[model samples]
Every structure is written in C-alpha cells, then in structure tokens.
Target chain A: MRLCKKTLIWDTSIKWLLVKKMFFILLFTCFIFDAPVAGKDIHVGKDHTIQTIRQGLMKAADYDRLIIHHGVYHEDSLIIDKPIEIIGKQGAIIDAQNHEVDIITIVADSVTVKGLQFRNVGTTFLSEPAAIKISKCKYVTIQNNYIQDCFFGIYVGNSRHCRVINNHAEAAFKEQVSAGNAIHAWKNKHIQIHGNRVHGYRDGIYLEFVNHSSITNNNSYDNLRYGLHFMFSNHDIYQNNTFRNNGAGVAVMFSKKIKMINNHFVHNWGGSSYGLLLKEIVGGEISQNHFEQNTIGIVAEGATRIIISDNRFTSNGTALDMKGNSIDNQVVRNNFLVNTFEVVTNTRYNQNQYMNNYWSGYSGYDLNHDGFGDVPYRPVGLFAKITNSIPAAMIMLHSPLVNLMEMGEKVFPGLTPEGLTDEAPKMKPYAYD
Target chain B: MLKISAVILQNLLRNKAIFGYLVLLCFTGWGMFLYESQPEKAVLSILQIVLLVLPLITLIFTTTYYYHSQEFLFLLLAQPIKRSDIFAGLYIGLAIAFLAVFFIGIGLPVLLFASGMQSLFLLLSGLLLNLVFIAIALLVGVGVHDKSRGIGVTLITWAFFAFIYNGLVIFMMYQLSDYPIENLILVLSFLNPVDIARIMVIMKSEASALLGLSGAVFQDFFGTAKGGVVSILALILWSIIPFWITHKMFRKRDL
Candidate 1:
C-alpha cells in the first residue's frame, strides 16, 4: 500500500513539472508572435529588409518603435497615425524632393521623432509645408532634428504636452517675407520649446493662442521680423533666451501672466526696433533681462499691471518708452546705464511707478549712506518729450540746449510730467554680473 | 600773412575769453571723465557740451575781435600787407588759437581716458564745428556795419541752430507725421551744420543705437564709409560757403 502511494505522488509531481514547461513555452510563443500589446522595434534601412520608413511604419503596430538606419530617403510625405517612435541613426537624412505638401505629418498622440535631418521642402503659401507638423497630437516629442529650407520648420497646431528640443531650424532664402516662422504654435497648451537655434525666418518663435508654455535657452537671430512674436498667448515663461540682430528683439502683445526672465537682447538696432516690445500685455513680470544697443529697450504701449524689475538697459536709444494707456506698471531695481533717454512718455502724468533703480546718468547725491540717492531721480528728459510727438527732433540728440532743458526741468518739474520720478534711486547697481 | 597771423595770434591769445574758455573746457572735460564711469559716455557728454558751448564762444570771440580791433585793422590796412593777407591772417590766427585750446582742453582728456574711434570722431566733429562757427562769426562781423548788431545777429544765429531749429523741426514733424515724409525729413536734417556734424558724430558711436528708424535710414546713408566721406564733404562745404562769403565781404569792405 505504501509503494502504491509513493508511485502516485511521483506521477503527480512529474505531471506538474510538464505542465510548467508547457506554460513557459506557450508564453514564449505569445511574446514572439503576438507583439501588439507589447511594442517592438522595426528596423528600416537600405540594407535592411524593410527599406523604407513608410513600410516600417505600416508594419509597426501601435506603441512600436521605428529604428531607422543612416541613409537618404526621398519621401514626399509620411502620415504617422499610430503611437510610435521614429528614431533616426546618426546622419539619417529625409529628402522631401520638393514635391510634398508636408514632409512629416503627425496625427496620432504620443509620437516621437528624433535625430532626423529634413531638407528641401517645397513652398506653397496656401498651406505651409513644414519639415515636421504635429496636428492635434498630444504628448509628442520632436527633438534633435536639423531642418533646413522648409516653408516652416516645426509647426504645432492644437497640440498639448509637446516638447521641441534642441532643433536647429534655418532657411537659405535671402528674403524673410517669403519664409515662415521657425517654431510656430497655434491654440496649444503646455508646450515646451528649448535649445533651438533659429535664423532667417519671418519670426523666430511665433505663438498665437498658446498658453502655459515655457520657452528657454533659444538663440534666435537674423530674422526679418521680430525674433519672437506672441499674440493672445498667456501664462508663458521665457527665460535664458538670447535674441541678437533680429529686426526687433521680441514682441509680446495681448498676453497675460508672462514671466520674461534672464533673456539677453543685443544689437537689435533699427528704426522702430526695441529689445522687448510690450504692447497690450497685462500682469507680466519682466526681470533680469539685459538689453544692450537697441533703438528702444522696452516700448510699453497699452501695457498694464506688469512688474519690470532687475533689468539692465544699456546704450539704448531710449530706455523705457511708454507711449500711453500704460497703467500700474512698476519698474524697480533696474539698472539704466548710459541710455540716450532714460524714460519717455506722451501721457499727461506717469501712470507707472519707478523705484530703486540705478541710472548711470543719475546726478543725485547719496547723503543717507543707505545706497539711495537723497534727491529723487526724474528720468523724463525734455528731448524725449519733444521726440514723442516729433521724431525729427531726434536730429538734435546731442544739443546742449536739450540737456539744459532737462536740467531745468529737474529743478522745477512742470512741463515734463512731475509725477515721473524715482523716489528711491540706488547709488550703485544691483548685484548683476 | 605770416607776420599778421603771428600778431593776431598774440593779440587774441592774451584776451580774457580764451583764458576763460581754457578753464571751462579743462574743468568740464576732465570732470566728465571722472564723473561718468563709461569712457564712451564721457566722450559723448563732452561732445554735446562742446557742440553747445564751442560755437557760442567762437561766434562771440571772432565777432568781438573783428569789431574791437577797428583801429588795428586800419593800422594793418595802412601797412604794406595785402588786404586778403590781413583778413586771411586774422581768420587763420583766431581759428588756430581756438582749435589748439579746444584740442588740449577736450581732446587731451578724451585721449587719456578713452582713446578709440569714438573719441577721435568726437574730436573731429568738435574741430569741424569750431571752424564752421568761426567762419559764420566772421561772416556776421563782415556783414553788419555795427559791432553790437553783428554780435546780436551772431547770437541769434547760434540760438537758431542750437535751439530754435530743433523746436521747429519738432513742430513740423508733429504736424506732418500722417504723411510719409521719412526721406524728406532726413534731407532736412542736413540743412543745419550742427545737425550735420551731429550726424557724423552720433552715427558711428553708441548713440547710433538710440536712433530708431530714422537712425537706421541715417546709418544706411551716413553710417557707411561713403556716408562718412559725403558728410565730411558736406560739413567742409558748410564752413567753406560761410568763409567764402566772409572773404568776399571783407575784400570789398571800406574799413
């Protein structure tokens, strides 16, 4: 009876081991055959069996990856409708061959295109042929792409949680009027644009109806129009961006809750050019910005409720030109260094307040030793006032008579708005590097 | 011409105005360098001061000298010197004296503190303005028969160039802003010698950044090497025209 029971236990143990082996084999086959739920990589190259990226995309299921090898592929347009990742190897080239309306159109969410070089997209004004256009897509990342001579470099429309990272976008055309914006977005939210080198476009970064976006570390130069143009975009933070030699540095209009920080605007010298053109903007903070050699540093027209602080304005034609309708704007802790005009306004009285600033042209004494000047610093010069209405008065920019008028007005402030004065002017510049 | 020039130089250098000008310029020139930390800015401020004050001094000094030295002119006229030689000697003597004073007074400090293209440009413009104003002053002296009237006209002309002209331009531009007078206004800027000199100085310096669209246009026209050559030529013409008028009037004068 004991021998029979042992044999029965041995038999059951052997059956259980066989059952485990069969289960693992079934899981292995499932992993190898059914890769829909689990994503896989499809290799595409001239040498690979899948020669085209379009064929790779067709074969790839949702959430799969297309690993493209280094080769030149002449494709007009590729419509990506699946949640896939298209990563190009080093020196991977995508030649649009000048026939496509759009180079790479992303229609699905959670798609990524990285390390690809796109070139020679045809032009049509009716619809801009972008090197990469993400339409109605979310959580998309387009990074490390070098796009040259496209109608538009990267166009994002109605997309959210999209990041455009480290992309170099440039055009070879001489006329910027025919070129489009490098990185353009419309009606989008939560977008991040950083580390972009954009040049020779209509505008460097154009955003209309965009919100909650962060733009940082972009070097935008040589654009025909404004380096950056934003209209109706709100809750945006732009920091650590350098704009140089553009038509005008940046124009922020009809936006609110913007934080412009630590940006460098250099040599935007032109007629009607400004380092930062703030128009019809509300509730923004512009701080730690360095504006050097611009026609006008900050031109505020119809701007309201903004904090302009910690900015350095040097060698500009006019430092702060408040046209009119500017209300409750506070300029504090700024360094105005050798600007032609410290402040110029056309209003009856100064609607904005100035405080705790260091003017290189400041003549007041610091008696209290508290680093604040004893006399208030009034920045509205007589020449500035004259030029507000008469631009031709600028010809006499160095007339001692105008300087005399300013000195006289400083002693007795009446003709030049008496309300415009920095009550606490700093004896020295703030700790700015 | 040489002997007369030496005598005129001795006579003018000993006058109180030159001494006063020397003291004022030295004080302001070094003071600007010490006060403004930026060298370019010091040069610019000093340039503006020179533009405003230099012409006034030149006008006053030249006109007053011409009027005050009536007996001396008569003495020189009685001598064996040519009429052109006397007038030319007097003009050159006065111009060189003032130029030397200004050069040492303003130019030295600028060179010591900030020696660059900007400083050189300022000095050049200052020199040009001084010569131009001297010519204008001499013209007014020869044009008017009376001393006080000549001084008055000179003063009025200086005021017009320095103050009233800019005011008029402002008024005109404000009135005509609706019209596309961009090019028209730029051409009008060259009408004033002061403005022309200012364009030369400001276009190549840091002040060019302050010039907006008008500045851009001015730079496109005046910021180039060709622009510099043209502007310098125009400024020379400004001085020459006034000097030629003065020369003609002095040559035909009865005194």
Candidate 2:
C-alpha cells in the first residue's frame, strides 16, 4: 500500500511539471509571434509606381504608419479595428467599388486616414452606407483628401474628439435618392470640424443630436440644402466659417447655449433663405459676424435669452425679422447698415432689450460722444411691425400715405406690439477691425 | 400554329434550367417580402433588384428557349404556315410559359403584400416589361447568326439601356447646359424605357417626396392621363420596334 501511494504522488508530480513547461512555451511563443502582427509596415502599390494597398484589416496595432501608394485598390468594407496611421502617397485611390455594403469602417482609436480618393458606392434606400464611416471611435483625424461621387462621403456618428480637417466631398448630382450628404454627424460629441471645403451636397456639414462640438474656419458653399445645419445640437461653438451661395446659409433650430462668432455669411440669396435662421433657439451669443447679401439676416422665431452684439449686418434684405413668441432677448452693440428692413417684431416684444446697437440711419445725437445716444433709438419700425402681422400689408410699405401713417404711429405708438422700445441705443457704430 | 405552340411549350416546361430559375425567383421574391418592413418597404428595397434580376432572367430564359426551339421551328416551317404566325406562336408560347413561372414567383407575393390599383399596375407593368424584354431577346435570336453573338448583343443592349444610357443622358444635358431645354428634357426622358417605368411606378407611391420639389413638377406633368397614355405608347413602341426589325430582317435574310 505504501509503494502504491508513492507511485501515485510521483505520477502527479510529473504531470504538473509538464504543464508548467507548456505554459512557459506558450507565453514565449506569443511574445515572439505577435511582434510582426503588432508593429509591421506594409507597402501598397509596390509593383506599379503607385503602390497598391492591400486591405484585410482585422486589427491594426503597433504599426506606426501604413503607407499606401497611388493606385485603385478594390476592397470590400475594411474595418480599422485597432489604432494605426494610414498615409496615402501621391493620391492613392481606395475604391471600395461598391463591393460590400460599406467601405473603410472604423471602430478603433487614434486612426488617421489621409490623402486618398474614394468613389463608386452602392446605394440602398434602407441603408445609408458612406465611403469612410467611423462609429464610436475616438481621436480620429480625417484630413487632406478628395472624395467625389459617393453616396455619403465621410460619415462619423457616435464618435468623440474627432478632427475632420481640410477634406473635400462632392456627391454625384443624380436623382435625389442617390445623392447623400457630404459630412454627416449624428449623436456625436466633442468633434472639431475645421478648414474643410465641402460643396454640392444635400447638406455640406450636418450636425444632429450633437453637443459640445466646435466648427471653425470651414467653407461650406454651393450645396443643395443649408450650408451648415444643426438640430437638437447644444452648447456648440461655431466660429470663423464662411457659408456662401448655398440654398440657405445656416439654420439653427431646437438648440440652446450656442455661440455664433465672427463668421462670414455671404450671398446665400434664394427664396425664403437667410444668413442665419434661428427657430426655437434659446440662450446663445451672436457676436462680430459679417452678414452680407442674404435674403434675410438673422431670422429669429421662438428664441429667447440670446445676446446679439457687435455684429456687422450689411446689404441684406429684411434683417432681423422676429416672428414668434419669444421674450427677454437682448440685441446690443451691433451695426445694422443699409439693410432693406432693419427689424420686424411680430409678437409682443415687451421684455426684449434692443440697446446700444449702431444703426446707420440713427438720427439721435451723442452729447457726450461716449458712443451712446442721448435719446433712445427704436430699431423696430411701425411699417415692419404691421407687415409682420399681415404679410399682405407689405404692399403698404413704400406708399407715401402708408409712410405718413407709420410716422404718425411711431410718434404716438398705438396698436403695435405693446412696450417695444430700445433704450440707450448707440449713436456711433460698433466698430470691428 | 396552335399545335406547334403546344409542342414547343411542353418541351420548355420540362426543362430543368427553367425549373431552377422559377424556384430561384420564388425564393428571392419570398425572401425579399419576408425581410421587408411593409409592402411599400419591399417595393423600395427590391426596385433595383427587379430592374436587374427580372431582365437577366428574361434574357437568358428567352434566349435558351429560342435556341432550343430552333429545330422544332424548322420542322414547323416545313409545314404549310405563315412565317409570321410561326414566329408569333413560338414567341407567344414561350412568353406564356415564362409568364406562368414569373407570376407564380413574383406575382403571388405581390398579391399578398401590395394594395390598391397601384399594386395591380405594378404587376401589369412587370408583366409587360417581361414581355418586352422577352420579345427583345427573341429579336436578337432571330437577328444574329451565331448563338454567342446573339447572347452578346442581348447583354450589351441590356447594359446600354440599364447603366450607360442614364449616364449618357446626363452627359448630354451637361453638354447642352447653355440651352433652355426643360421641355426637351421631358421629351428626351421618354427615350429610355427604364426611366419611364421608374417614374410611372414612383409617382403612384407616397415616396415621390424622394425626388424633392423638382420631381413634383415632373409628376404633375407626367403622372397625368395624357402622360400615362404617352408612357403606354412608348413602352408599346419599345416592344414593337425590335419585333418589327427582327421580322423585317428574317424576311429578307438567308437562314
């Protein structure tokens, strides 16, 4: 019995020793074999002068730079499942060829896709698959490339801290069902869209269900719809952008805590178009922007607690038409020069502040020369007030008899919106250099 | 003529390839319906597939039918009958056989899911398209001497009508961009059979909003009674041209 017990213990000890040896061997093999998979550089388009990029990216790790040469590389949808830098040299073309549903979908972190041309996407009415779609990704930079004739060019949704800079997107202007937006961002946060030229899309850059993003220095023009559009997006800063010659310049609706600063809104003239159409916008700042040659400059409806200060509005038709049940907003220290109609306040404008703004037609004098007018200037005109209530009443605007009636009403304010006044308006223009 | 059609139809009905295609269509149509959200959803999802898959099936099936019936056609020609009647019988007989399979495959589900006169219209339109395409295939089979060349001509014609035609139209518009040619554009739209059919069916649906406001104007003009008459005439013309050409060629040419 003693000899049998000793033999069993020895057998168990041998089994444990073999297991320990196998574990070490596996650990060593993994550390060595994974080296190439993690940090390898692959060159594309090696045979031709323009290198062909091979794409079967299950994952990208430890690879510093993936260099793609210039050639049309047909791939199905490739997922950048890990972190990597993809650099295209001499205009490499990543043609998905509409092979699969989507193309170059990224769900990884710290990915950079630069200098590539993409086209020929499949269109499914049920599925809006883009050429380069990034979902739930972070620190992704899509910069310095041209994308043309795609269904949707670069779509990023549910992503954070992404930078879409200096890219061009032009869609095929076919049937409306086939054409899609250039850059579509929905349910996204903390994105920076800067210095991109987007044109001839359904919308140039669209932000829906977004928050805390910054759109700066982007030129959005010649699009079918609004140049830069946002809905249900809040606390976002849009500054230093040029939106010109689109169907409509820019529209901000159902949003709050927004800032529009120092942007150029120019020549977006069309039927029912505006430099900025604000609907249901609340608690925002609009400062130092140039609004020129738009049909309507700064159309406001159902917006409250917004500060409009130190902006230049020139050469626009029907500037600042307030059309809804808004209260307690301030329009201060802005220059309104040669606009067709300065202000049209339709609803009760009792609680709103219109002070310290420079109107080029301001006849009030500054006794102290402190840039504040001694007598208060009313920006809302009597004829404008009437026209807002009855759009057909606009026929009475240029009539001398209607003009005399407007002057009489302004002298003794009757039947207009009650207590609409601009106390402490500016005598001199609010200058910006 | 009736006896000739009976013999040709019975032989075609027995073919395994035709049987497979019938099964494939039924399975695909059923799968499309099952996967879709609603009748309208199925229509929108399968519109492109209908354009591509239906024509392909018609082309291949009709071509094979024409080739297989050649020997039988010669035998029938040896008897006392008009060539026109023989061509008509073979063409109509093959069409009836293919239509039976297509109705069982694409039509039954369409009946189950689709609603209103539009659905009936879609069914009739699909059947008419199949007839036209089958007629086109038969014309090619009669025109080309080599079987491969016949198939090639049919495929190239399909490609021209399907893919390149629209692109060429757009290119033409771009080339003539300086001209005030909206009415001309409307007239030119009738030149392509696919566009006419697409516009007709789409105008019937609520998804006409997909074309935005410009399409509304087109619909206002093209969805009228006059437009409907014109479209039907165009489709009939499309069918008649190839048949007439083939009939004319076959009359003159040595077999």
Residues A2-48 of candidate 2: C-alpha lDDT, one tens digit per residue: 99999999999999999999999999999999776566665667564
lDDT digits (tens) for residues B22-83 of candidate 2? 89878867777886534554654445545666777788778867876788778877888888
Give lDDT for model 1.
0.87
DockQ of 1: 0.35
DockQ of each: 0.35, 0.01
Q: Give the per-residue lDDT digits (tens) of candidate 1, residues B1-255.
A: 988889999987898988899999988998888987777678777877877888888898889988898789989889887888988898889888999999888989988998887777778888888889999998998899898889899999999998888667766778887776667767887788888877788877766655565546666777788888887888788899999888888888776
> Candidate 1 has which clashing residue pairs, if any?
A271-B212, A271-B213, A317-B210
In model 2 chain B, the worst 10-residue window by lDDT is: B206-215
Say which candidate scores most in lDDT.
Answer: 1
iRMS per model in Å: 2.7, 20.5
**Model 2, C-alpha of A145: deviation from truth (Å):** 1.7
Q: For model 2, report the TM-score of its A chain.
A: 0.84
Tell me the tens digit of each residue's lDDT in model 1 across A249-345.
Answer: 9999999989999999999987667889988999989999999988889999999999999999988888888876999999999999888888888
Give the lDDT of residue A35 in candidate 2.
Answer: 71
